[model samples]
Target: MSGEREPVSREESSTVAAVQEEAEAVALVPELLISDLLRYGVLLSLSLVTLGTLVTFLRHPDYLVSSEALQRLTAPHPVPHGLRDVVVGAMAARGQSFVMAGLLVMMAVPVMRVGLSLLIFRQQRDTVYVAITTAVLALLGLSFLLGAAE
Candidate 1:
């Protein structure tokens, strides 16, 4: 035989098969990790929020009245015509809009986290994902503080 060995057939190409499987396995790891993190984070966050909201309600249960309840209480069974406008106006201002907005953002933080997590998954980037995750958590906490103040 010549100094050079005989060329291998396609079936003998182990490097290509190993590389292909490694690539797929590598792609799967981050996606699985992200999904797990999001699920756990959401559960933990919701639990904490539920506890805090309950504690707050316990501390000041009077603020739990719905707008309709407030209206009904302010008016008799057959509300007086003149009083209807006043009741409506009062109901309109029942909740603090700014606080509500803050609360809404708080509620959306986990959702935003999911989106950012997916972005990270697609881009295979870590720095931005970690930074954004921290920011979302911080903002969510701030919103909770603002909401709790009301």
Candidate 2:
């Protein structure tokens, strides 16, 4: 057998291109998933916030008529501080609680995205990104801890 390269064939090249396209499509799936995650997360957060505001206005119509009611609501209170409180309050149809939960959900979206990216990178065997994403996750956790301490 002659030690020479074979001539490129249209069929072979097209097969190679098809394989590359398939790989690209596979890569896009994760990106699309992440995109959808962010989109839906934000949308859900917005919806919750809107619903909460509507409920608040409906329940406390005085807020619409009086600045005092708005001021009172804006005043800091420690009732719905914990996760359990937020969940219970939200379940009980409390507007403020729903707003709190919505804000929490809004804050959580990016963190969730990062966590998802880490998983994707890990699955893809991308060590660099995995490490970076891990570091970012750790930093986010640290921020939450520090903020809680404040």
Candidate that would win on lDDT: 2
The lDDT of each candidate is: 0.57, 0.89
TM-scores for candidates 1 onward, in order? 0.32, 0.78
Task: Show model 2 residue runs off by greater than 4 Å.
Answer: 1-21, 75-79
Q: For model 1, how does the per-residue alpha-carbon lDDT over 34-72 read when each residue is reduced to its tens digit?
A: 677667666665655565455545655675865665775
What are the RMSDs of all candidates, in order? 13.7, 5.8
TM-score, cand. 2: 0.78
Which residue pairs overlap in candidate 1's backbone?
none
lDDT of 2 at 35: 97
lDDT per residue as tens, model 2, 47-137: 9999998998899888878988766667886566667899998889989788888899999999999999998999999999999999999
